[model samples]
Target: MSGNIAKHVFVMAGTGSIGLIAIFMVDLLNFFYISALKNPSYTAAVAFAGSLGFILSAISIGSSIGISATVSRLIGAKKRGKARRYAATFLAVMLCIATLLAALNFIFSRQLVSLIGGKGEALEGAVLFLRILAPAFPLLCLVMAISGLLRSLGEANAAMRVTLSGAVCAAVLDPIFIFGLDLGLTGAALGTIFSRILICANGWYQLSKHDILAFPRLKEIKPALKAIAPIALPAIATNLATPVGNLFVTRTMSHFGNDAISALSVIERSVPICFAFIFALTGSIGPIIAQNFGARIFERVKETYRWALRFTLGCVALIWLIFFLNQNLLIKLFHIQGIGIPIIHFFCDYLVEGYAFLGLLFVSNTAFNNLGFAFYSTFFNWGRATLGTIPFVLIGFYWGPEGILTGMTAGMALFGTLAYFKAKNVIHNLHLRFPEALA
Candidate 1:
């Protein structure tokens, strides 16, 4: 606990906290921009916002994973000086990449949203959201890198503070800016960006205090990148798949009209809360798995995986119980009234059914990703996103929004089965290969 264990938790807590809020940020955006949520334009805005956030997420995951991997490995190997050097170079590279990303995003905010089908007020709203949110990129990257470093170092408690700060900021500002100021969707985006900025500042301060922020240096970046790329790339690929799946979901829903799309947006924003326990489990288990795997404590690695799976699945099951008992009331919470009632019943039923299928898929993919089998995780997602699911959604063009949900459920149920089988194979193989590890 004094060494790698502490550092990993420290980073994990901060990263997970931000991750949790970031997961819910979509809802925050909608809550603030109530009109945008209902406007076909708003759906597009939501799509664009989701796409951009995800793209950054992919980049951040890739960059941070690599950085943390390289530094942590060196530290594990007792190469303290080398670890420091690696951390310094990684901070420089990631900051530059994040800054340039913000700039590029600023330039092409409108165009990017347009590709995802944004038009009219939604497009304008998206541009406003992106333009405002773009500048936070550098800070986000820096903080993610620093936070990852801290987690790698076992200053997890500090890292948690950084994320809690962002979540708290967004949580508080959501009501004040969105409802109070009536800033709507833009207000939500502002609150989220503001939160990220705050985390960035805090993360940077901690990172610098720990001497991880040695920017303005050009030394050894290539080697550092090389060291981190293998580990990070898979995680990035896994991260990118969410947006890819989102792109199709957006396209399919839009066919039913703006209102249908809007309803879909609401569910997307809200459903994650239902899966919170599983995600928290993944965050905690990943570093434990990573460190144990690093140290060649193979038995403990397998044992941890089993415990994580059982533990997560149990929590998910309990959540499902609560959801089942009060789904009607839960659906009512969105207050998706007014014109939103168009496909409201459809959404309520869809969530009730689809959540059951997604339960297995979501937890399995998370466990795989955390187990460092991220490429496998991404493959499952890519299958769901592009290959098997798109055809199912298209079959519903004539049926309207209800058909879209039905088709989506069908595709996911099919793909979720596929993911489940693959995960079983993985779990089976691990158990067999390391019998003593699990013992």
Candidate 2:
């Protein structure tokens, strides 16, 4: 049992390392432009636009979640053919959804930015960015489906490579387009689209090579859609909560001027970089748990949860220490000036501690989803978004930018604690009822 868990972690971590490097490299490149521009309002605009894109792109992942859950179960039941069918179905669904989303992005780019409280040059930049990236939504969705498919098959390394390839491509292109070509914001968006196309193509090649991915026949589509919809909707909703909550946070930050909004953007982008391992652990273990659960190996399911939480929290601690010890150097790396600097400082100093609890929340969400308690994860997250975020953010509004971070920390602490206990109880009850199934 120990050996298996260790192996899964190792694979997951290896993928996680590559993914982290890729994500940070892309984000850092974007920030390099922001820093080089040395304009707070411009930074805020880019961040706001980026946030809109980020939130919308997340739904594609929701589709992948449903696909992953289905694939894991099929694999656990030793139903390889059915698993591949779902993979085909996933591509079909993602393509359809991505088309609609991309159209919306193009049509309502201005309104989308406006709704997010973007205005002036910031709004203009956001509209340009979204429009430029709009067409790639389908490609992005397909990439997500492929990655989730690979992870379900216990091919985290392959999935990581696909993601890394995109990241490396984006990082390489970002500088050339943004600076070499002097395309400015459009360059950034184009860079992103090109990289995503690369990822999608690579993913398709792998899936086709494995004979696992295909365009579904009309007949195969309905049943596959039926199976995925139930899981996908709630899973999507669960994924939506954070970004929805972030919308509120971003809107709140907007009132504090471009500096505050830009600072929040910087931190948001920086998170995946700093806590990539935690994110990787959360994703990597979901399939492991789901496979065990599907096979009725309740003990292994429970063990994965405990080990994952421990491993994730440990990563958070180590990251926190690193961030704390070198906070000054890290701050300088962003080349931020004026208000953004102080805001960044406050985050590194005090709010950074909250990440441990956030790690707990992430692991708990994965556990719930993999354990067939998708609604529970959804409820907990949306509950946090509303009951947890609104009140704390309101309270923090009184203290300015630093206070917002405090409010965020408070909300996550409360919700994260509750989620941990709820998941613990759920796991305990499962073991109690299925004691004889502990194979």
Candidate 3:
């Protein structure tokens, strides 16, 4: 509705986008590791490592959701002290959770790989990569918690700076460790972990200075978790939809052999790099929506959604065009070989077009989480995974990976439509109920 809102979205997006872009950029570097090794099994190993990392990071990511929910509300209520206490409790809880996850993953790395369909050297390599990366989970969780706390406090630029710095460090270190040291896959893991350590270290120092990071008290733990769990648990389940859905997709691709899964891995990692701004748009707008919703300014909430959808759609369109024009060049750039090339070609032809719908889904998920409709977000995602992915993928299996991409697109279309309408209705109802506040 106004230039000011658009300004806020762009400013926030500018900083927020870089963090994930850096993360995914390094993920692409992992794909490069696979290509450099020129082994299908190694490609599969990279795919498996990326998937497992996403699953592990869910603990922190989901906790960030809860932190955002709790902290945003507290910030809105002007409860800075309680928000600080919850922030402390969040770090403590996340540390315990991360440690437990790290231990389990380290001990069961092989079994975990096998569980996800890794075999032979691929299994071994993935295990090594995962174990090397496991200890960083705690550090990563702390980074996410602190960054999220800063975002909730309307300090998104600070959070952005914290995460982007990590990403930059990772980018510089990745090749050095992977290539320079001749450490291979384990080297990639080392680079990523070291960068994470940097983020966590810098994040703590920055937050402490802001008086945001605090020591956890025994008394605060219970209430902090109590406040956070309702939002966090559902949000976690909601977030799991992607990785779980991805797990199923990767498993399906595995049936087609390593080349297929490897190709899918490249696409997965690359797509985020191309569409980082979509994430930035959704993420940066969340606190804006949340604060307005809490303040009962329903129209501003609606306008935020409107501008976000416009921006995301525009960006995805341009991405589709760029990739379409340079499809052959991109294939050459990645130096993809074997069945992976055809799969990449097919994705660029068909699945790349579905990103607009996918972008809408990202926006709607943010809307639901910020507006207190997290369960809806969870429902749509899991529904897409099961109701959307399972049947289509089963049928598409007959036609190969192309068919699988078709199935995934169908799911995106279905849920994306549902999420948008649901978000609109929520805002409309809020408008009616809070007419006085709107005035």
Best by lDDT: 3
In model 3, where do residues sit more than 4 Å from their true spots? Answer: 1-4, 75-78, 291-297, 429-439
Clashes of 3: 0
Ranking the candidates on TM-score from highest down gives: 3, 2, 1
The true-versus-predicted C-alpha distance at residue 113 of model 1, in Å, is: 2.3
For all predictions, the C-alpha RMSD in Å is 4.7, 2.5, 2.4
Candidate 2 lDDT, 1-439, residue by residue in tens: 3458766865776566676567456655676675566667667777887777667757987888889878887878988788788778767867887899899989999998888789898888889887888888888788788887887777777887888898889878988988899888888888888888898888777776666665577787888888888888887888888888888888888887777787788788878787877877887787687777767777787788888877877777777777678767766765566666788888877777798888889889988887768777888789888888988998999998888778988999999999999999988788666556544
Backbone-clash count (model 2): 0
User: What's the CA error at residue 80 for candidate 2, in Å?
Assistant: 4.7
Q: Candidate 1 has what TM-score?
A: 0.81
Model 3: per-residue Cα lDDT over 256-329, one tens digit each: 77778788888888888889898888878987998788778777988899989988888878888887788788
Looking at candidate 1, what is the lDDT of residue 47?
50
Return the candidate ranking by lDDT, descending. Answer: 3, 2, 1
Compose the digit string of candidate 1's lDDT tens values, residues 90-178: 77777787889899999998888777667677779779888877887776676677678877777777776777777777778767777
